[model samples]
Target: MEFVRLLLLFLHLLGMGMLVAMFFVQRRAGADAPLNKGWLHAAALQLLTGVALVGLAPLTDQEYDHAKIGVKLLVLVVIAGLVAMNVSKPKPATWLTPTLAALVVVNTGIAVFWT
Candidate 1:
């Protein structure tokens, strides 16, 4: 169970990294790059792994803090929603990646710095 938790954590971070990477790629492409499948996949993985991590925390003998988890979950939902909304667009809104990236960073900060 501990190993499973670790794996989920890894996947969660992988998804976060993927989001940041896509943000950079989109910025570099300068509106030429549409939201790719990678974005959706990453968002899904991030969401799934995050929930699973919370569910599995008890198995690892960790206490679940509902407040922190709830905040992070809310941010992730926004990130996922943004990705889903833009995935099918021929040209996503100019603020999409910037907003998503900022939210991602905010979530990460919450995860790392929240008590």
Candidate 2:
């Protein structure tokens, strides 16, 4: 169980790192490029690992603040929604990358500090 938890945590952190990396990657793609599909993939990874961690808490003899988890989930949902909506466009909005990056940072802050 501990190993499972650690694995999930590792994947979650990787998802966060992917999001951070995507920010820079998107920037370097130029103003006319489509939003990368990597954004959706990373958001999905974060979402799945996050929910699995929460779902396995009892089995792992762990506990979490429900309100904090809820808030983080909400933020992640927003990030995923933004990505899903824009992933197919010819060119993303100028504000989209920054907004997504800010949301990602906000979500990470919540996870780290909301204990």
Candidate 3:
């Protein structure tokens, strides 16, 4: 179980890194399609793996009470909402990607330090 947890964590981080890199690359290239697909896939995978880990972990109520976890979840929700909103419209890759990347980093930080 510990090994599984670690593996999930590793994959989650990898997905996040991919997302951030895709965002930056897209921003530089002035292209959105490739980055959008990559970001969507990475974000979906991260969310799935993250939820799996949380379900598998032996967490107490006190652990759930931490502000960091709440903040991270809120960020995740915002990211999801943004993704949904932008899925149909065409716009410059400015705010959403960076914000999502920042949230991913913050989520990882909270997972590492708060737990």
Candidate 4:
């Protein structure tokens, strides 16, 4: 189970990196591509794996668990909203990519250090 959890964590981070890279590439190119499809897919995969990790991990009475879960969910929702906004506007916002990437990093930190 620990090995599986570690693997899932690795996959989750890889997916997040892909998504962040896609956003940066889009920013540089000034145009979107079918690659955005891959970004969305990766983001979804990360979210799934992250949730699975939380579910499979042993229970703890620490308040940090609930806080971490809440923050992760909030960040996920923000990222999804950013994606939706970009889709609707036909262009990614100036701050969207950086903001989402920062959120991901912060969430990762919380998972690694707060727990």
Candidate 1 C-alpha lDDT tens digits along 3-115: 89889989999999998898888888788678776777888888899899888777877787899999988988888888888888888888888898899899999999998
lDDT score for residue 34 of model 3: 33
lDDT tens string, model 4, 1-115?
6678778878988887887787677667664432255556766887798787777777422123777788877877777666765655555656666776787677677768875
Off by over 4 Å in 3: 31-35, 59-66, 113-115
Q: Best candidate per lDDT, number?
A: 2
Residue 37 error, candidate 4, Å: 2.8
Better of 3 and 4 by TM-score: 3
lDDT of each residue in 58-100, candidate 3, tens digit only:
7412224447656766877777777777766666456766777
Task: Answer with 1 or 4, whichever has the higher lDDT.
Answer: 1
- The candidates, ranked best first by lDDT, are 2, 1, 3, 4
Model 4 misplacement above 4 A: 31-35, 59-64
Candidate 1 global lDDT? 0.86
- Note the residue pairs that clash in candidate 1: none
TM-score quality measure for candidate 3: 0.74
On TM-score, the stronger of 2 and 3 is 2
TM-scores for every candidate against the unseen true structure: 0.92, 0.98, 0.74, 0.73
